[model samples]
Structures are given as C-alpha cells and as structure tokens.
Target chain A: MNPPVYFFTDFSSRGPYLGQMESAVLAVAPQARIINLMNDAPFANPRASACLLAALNDYLPENAVVVAVVDPGVGGSRKAICLNIGDRWYLGPDNGLLSLLVSNAGAENCSLAGLHESYMKAASASFHGRDVFAPVAGLLVNGQSPDTFPLPVDGMAGASWPGELAEVIYLDGFGNAMTGLRMRNLRDLQGVVVGGQLVKPAYTFSSVPAGALFCYENSLGLLEIAANGSNAGRILGLEIGSPVNPHISPGRSKNP
Target chain B: MNPPVYFFTDFSSRGPYLGQMESAVLAVAPQARIINLMNDAPFANPRASACLLAALNDYLPENAVVVAVVDPGVGGSRKAICLNIGDRWYLGPDNGLLSLLVSNAGAENCSLAGLHESYMKAASASFHGRDVFAPVAGLLVNGQSPDTFPLPVDGMAGASWPGELAEVIYLDGFGNAMTGLRMRNLRDLQGVVVGGQLVKPAYTFSSVPAGALFCYENSLGLLEIAANGSNAGRILGLEIGSPVNPHISPGRSKNP
Candidate 1:
C-alpha cells in the first residue's frame, strides 16, 4: 500500500473531522493507499454498500483495510464492530455490510468481530465514521487487534432492515453516465427523475434519441443520462458530487 | 497548443509515415501541441473521426490544427481538403467528417476549407494525413497560408451523406483509444472488447460472485473487461493495446 490506510464512506457527515483523521493517518502511516470506494454509498443500504464492496473487493490492494460508514442510526444502541473475514478487515457499525461475507462462509465461522466502548469518543449522536470508525480503522491497519480499541458490545444490533435502495453518485461527460446505483432495484422501473428532467427512454446512449433526455442501466448498473449527439454531463449540469433525484414509475421496492 | 499536430486514424497503412510526420511536427513546431487523436479508428467512418474531433474540440488550444486520417476510398477519386470551422482548423479528407459537423455548420461554408497541391510530397498516395495532411496542418501552425501549397481541386464537392452519427472516440492509456464508433452502433450488445477479450457481464471485484467474468464501459466509457473477484485483465490474459472487439449487435442500425 503506497498510502497505508484506505477509508471508504458515503461522506454523509464528518467534514473537517474526516480531514483531520486523514491528516492523522498521514502523520502515522506515512504510506496509505486511500482508495475511494464511493463516498456516495446510498443513505443506508447494506446491499448497495455490499454491491459496491462486491464490485471493488477483487480490485482493492491486497490485504488493505476497508473502512466503510453508511450508518443511518449513527448514535443509537447500534454496536460498532471490527470484523476479520476472508483475509480482509472491516471496521464500521455492525450493519449488514458483513452479512454477505458471513453468509458466504455458510458455516458461521467467527474471526474477531467485536465492538468495544473504551474506543468511544464522547459518543456523539452522529458522526461515527469520524469519531469511532476512522480511528479504529487506523489502529487496525497498523496490525492492532479489534480489541485494541474496545471490547465487544453485547445485545446491540446494527442497522439491518433491508430497505429501499436509492443512490446517484457520479455523472460523467456526455451526460451518459451516473455510477453507484443498484441496478437490481431500477431494472424493472419505468420511472422518471428530477421531475421528469431525467427519464429512462432507452437502453444505452445509442438507443436514446439525440437531443432527447433518456436514462439507461449504465454498465455500472446505475442510472445515467445521455444524448446521442452530445454530452449528458453538460446537458444535466452535473459534476462529481451532484445528487440524483430519480422519479420512477411503478416506484421502487422502497427497500431492495 | 502545447502540442501541435494531432493524429487520429487506424494507421494500418500509414503508421511509420505518420510517425515521421509527427516527429517533424515536434522538431519543427515545438511550441505546438502534438496530440494523438488516435491510431485505432474503425475501418472507415468519417463520423468516427468527427466524434473524436468533437470530444477533443473543446479541450484544444486556440488555432490548433487537428490532423486526422480515415481514408478508405483514399486513392479513389475523393478530394483532399482542410476545413476551418468555428475557431480551429481540421486537415483531412473532405469526407463525412465535416458532414458530422453539420449539426453546427455546413462544410460548404468553410473559412479555409480548400485544397492545396504545391505542398504535397512527390509520389504521395491518397493517404494525405501522413505525407500531405500532417505536414500541411503543421505548416499552418508553424505560420503559413491556406494557399502556400496547391490550388483547391476545382469542383471538388464536399457534399453530404447520411449514415451513423459519430459521437465519441476512445482514449486508451497509451494515447490510442479505439474510438469513432458512435453510441448508435453500440446498443443491446452481447459482447465487445477491452485489452483484447470478448466481454459480457459487467462486474465489480467484490460484487462478482467469485469466478464471474465482467465487462462494462470502463471509466473511460470504452468497453473494458474486469473480473468481479480477480484481475480479469490478468486472468483472461490481456494487456494494453490488445484488441477489444465491440462487435455490432445483430440489431445495429445506421441511425441514432
């Protein structure tokens, strides 16, 4: 890892605090490989997060620490956990992020997934990614055990109520791309977004009419806008961090 | 332009010749931008060249002369011309490339879209982008006239034609992107290429359910192959410059 620590999050909260944590990593690790695994993970969908992780797991640097925070129940009784599974370590709220991995193991094998209170930093009502998750992840990457921070909290279930999956993270030039949406949720939708500003009219940029607004399942399996003769990005007036408000017909599953 | 003289072509026939011409541009016009539009244009489609032109049109420096070559009916009775539309000049065969620009302006109303013969190299074939086009574009950037060389071929009609609309060109890592095929040509596709492999399902490293092959429009919007859990690039065995066959789907049409 050229850059030792890799932090992944939805960037929902923790502004300068995140930056400060990054600075701490810089000072200590000095060689962190901070791969951005989509700061736009949907509000709180383990599937979306899992999909993203599933998509990127094979490509991440070997044995790199993957820190993700998609907590909607940040300051509740939810227990923050550190898990070691399949040669990788995950530190975050014991949300459903590990469900896929655990399910894959089939035998319910356990390997160091515990939440400790000693690591809590004032336990703010929100912002665990900055206060708890980031710091614990930093320590874990340096070869410290999950217990190095805290003892496993008992009877504290995480945010795992499989819900409606919604997300629109990245928009690229040609207005033909929007990455990070769960395609499984949108594949059946005949919906419109942005008050019909973005509509799924065709399958790809080619299928969409020129100068007409159209949506499709981009290879990323996310919603995207495109123009046959021009760029979708300029047309929609969006850049890296623009939010997508998709309006679907027949609506989505409320939670995929 | 920091680099002068751009080359966009398949270059199957005029590779070394264009290389010499490019060297000549840098040797002669160091202050100019010598961009590689491409050496991997599809067989013969002026619209493909046009898509490439548009993709780079906005990012180019003022007065930059873009040199392109997609001459299939080269030695045939096609006329050679240089078109000055908007703020830049395009030096290539007077084929449908300029026609693709019809959405903006007609080729007949060119500012300096004329022919020059005196600057032509002796014993040159119809592949002028190398011997004729590249040198001429370089000369103009080096400060010369539209008439310093040859007279416009009298009655050389730059008439229009109707075909697939060219929109974007691929920009590969080595500066060679297999572009020129518009989205109109890529829809409902079963398999295409990247790093020289037949690709289908688009999967992410982790999302891939172990041993699944993945194919998707890479970050660059060109078809790419990636494994969900492994390096498909290494597993399926591909490297840069390998052919990515984005074959025309059975339902492909000549329209967008």
Candidate 2:
C-alpha cells in the first residue's frame, strides 16, 4: 500500500495553489492518500516555520511523505532537496524550512540529498511546490526512489540557528496565536508577555473567564495564546513574527 | 476504484474541523482520494453558500462525492440528505444549501433521500459533518449503497428560493469578492455598482489600471469583483450577503 502524503505550505486555502499542488501529486500517484496538514504556515520566514514544523512532527503518520514548502525565495538559487527523517520523508527547498525537524532527528537518523535533475528541469521556477516537490513526494510515496546524492547536514541553511523561537509563528482561524516555543522547552512559567500584556496560562478556554487572554499548550504541544470566547490574536494585537517572552517563575531559567 | 471525495464547507482551514472530517472519511474509506475543494465558505449563510456550490458544480470529476456542510442548523431539526445530481453525489443538511443545485438540475434529473438512521444515531449532536455526513460519503464512494429512503424534492427546504442571488457570496484570500450571480446571467453589462462604486467589467486584472476595481468572470465562472493589484473587498467594504447591483446597458433587462 502506498503511504499518505501530507502538505504543509504557506499557500493560503483561498487560491488554486493548494488544489493545483494536490492535483500534481495525484497525477503521479493515482491512489495516494493526501491530506492538507497545513496551508497557512508563516509566509516567507523559514526559521519560525522550521520550529512549527518540528512541533507538528509528532502528529505525522509513520511512513508518510511530507511536502513542506514555505518558500518565499521561489525562482531563486535555493536547491530542491529531500530528507529521510526517521520513517518519514520530507521534500522541499533546502532553505531551512526542514532544518529544525532534521536537527531534532539527529544527523545519523536523517539523510539528506538533492532532488534529481530531471524533476527540477521541467518545473516552472515560480511553483516548485506543484511542479517539483509534489511529484517527488508522490514518487516517494509510491516506493519509487528518485535520483539523489548524499549531502552533509551541517551544510544546510539555518543548521546553526537557535533550537527554539519565542515569537508568534501562526494565527489560526479562531484568532489563536501559536508561538514557535514548545511546551516542553519551558519550566514553571507564570505567564507570557506579549504586546505589553501579561497573558496568564490556562489548561483550556473554559478554565478562564470569557474574553480573557491566556496561554496554553495547544493540541500540537506548542505554546499557544488564546482568548476565551473571543479572538485572542486580535485582542492582544499579535501577528506572525510577533515577539513573545515567556515569564518563567523566579529561581528557574527560561529554557531548560 | 473508489471515487474522490470533495469537501466544501465553512470550516476554515485554521481549526481541526476540516482535518477531522477528512479523518472520518479516511476511517471508513481507507483508500479514498480526498480533496478539500473549499473550506472557507461563507460562515452560517447557506443561501449564499448554495449559490456558490452550484457555481462550482462543473469542476467536480464524474462519479465524485461532495461533502458540503455550510449547515447553520446542524444538529437541529434539519434532516441529513443526499442528492444525486447528474453523475456526482452531494451529501449535506437538507436545508436550502442544496436547493439551488437541485433547482438548477430540473427536479427530474435529481433524486433526494434521507441518511440512514444507523449513521445518525452513532454521530455526535454538534458535529454531524464529521460524524454522520463524512462516513456516509465514504460509504457511497466505496461502492457500498448506504441505507437511504426516497424523498420528494419539492418538499425540501429552500425549494422556493430564487435561481440567482445578487449578493456577495464569498471573499477569496486575494480580497476578491465573488457574487452569487453567474456571468452567463448578464448581457452587455457595462459595470457593477457595488459599495456605490462603478466597477467596470474587465476581461482580466491586467486590462485595468493597478488598484482599479473591475468585475470579471473568475475561474469558477462567477462574476467576481477584484482590483488589479489591491484588495477590492477591503476597499469596497463588501462582505458576505452584501448587495450587488448590476448595471445593464440601455434597453436591456438586468437578467438575460
């Protein structure tokens, strides 16, 4: 059986880009199981997006092929690459969108390679997500190996970037702000400081008063700020790349 | 081979609803080909949504199953329904959401039925889209005849609604406003009067000046208002259900 293909891109759901990419995948793998893991990743910021990708890594199914594309530098000199991390595969531009996940998996457990020349040659410079990465992911899911050569992990862009990012990486439809900071990365946190407001943490929305701003570990295990029964992002004036300072309790460092 | 399942709903891409519904579909039809046709339908306004759905009918592949849920009356007295329109199957609430398409198909080519009680009993009250409609769609796609009974098309809700709606039904991510009025419904139209501005009809965005509002037939064949390089919806303050007036040329009726 062919494995499922997950799409994580900066392509907003409104346009034809998401649908066109899926069609490209289905063109190669006729019966492939496809899912839109995320179409609203932070547009153009690979560092914050890398952290978000790593946080969502645990939710991916075994033997899945992920097409991760947050490329703002499309049609540029960025190389198209694929990485075999654990049992899953990731195909995208080697512009640090996959760096955090690769770093977390350790170099030995991850093998990186550039995509074959044939796939890249026929692709349009502006839409590699559809022309290149999608087809490569479909080929990988169908158990066909694309031509590639091994590459050193350290040479990847953003390889030396910090492990955690303390900024808003995404804002969901419900107006919840998802930061790049993971729940496990902090200890004894009192609250988070954002937009000059002290937003306390809560386990769930109902635990706090209505319209109250609070931070919590969301389903993806990322530190998310939300407002009970209201739009937290709007109320707190937070947007993608907004700075967030975790207020750790006294006698403890911010990061473990 | 199982038919592809297309999801069209108001469930924005941000939350887990769309993914959960897809998961429910895959649970029943493990090998099903799923596509998110549209997840940002006008929230809770099925009248405008119905017109939008009818406009998108031409894009569905033959033998495809559509799970459309813009149901504001979900889990209420509304009945879960399935409509066999032409070669495709539509599964959703029996509200006016399906009325426009049913009416457009000439009741003779359409067949209506109520979902099986077994599926409804097993579903949660608030999320019939995920619990009930999704699984039934899976069954239909897998060549399994789900238990359903015949119903009269004339008795369905919204059966008496108009064929065309002269209102903004959707605002895409690009800030373009899509009206429920089809392009074919107009004749020798000079411009559309929306928000007290005369948006001249243009063949494409390039034909108009940058940031100039223009109306054109979008990819879906709907009359859409857009700016050359700016957001027309934001500039014109058009939202779902916003009234749109079409200015036909002299001596011609508004509707052809």
Indicate which candidate wins on TM-score.
2
Candidate 2 docking class: incorrect
* Residue A149, model 1, lDDT: 43
Candidate number achieving the greatest DockQ relative to the actual structure: 2
Q: Give the 10-residue window scoring lowest on summed lDDT in candidate 2 chain A.
A: A55-64
Candidate 1: deviation at residue B98, Å?
Answer: 20
Give me the candidate number with maximum lDDT.
2
Residues B127-198, model 2: lDDT tens digits = 688789988988987888889989999998899999888999999989999998888878898999998898
| Candidate 2, superposed: residue stretches over 4 Å from native | A14-16, A252-256, B1-9, B14-28, B33-38, B41-256
What DockQ, on C-alphas, does every prediction get? 0.02, 0.13
Q: Could you estimate the TM-score for every candidate? A: 0.38, 0.61
Alpha carbon lDDT of each predicted model: 0.53, 0.85
Model 1 CAPRI rating: incorrect
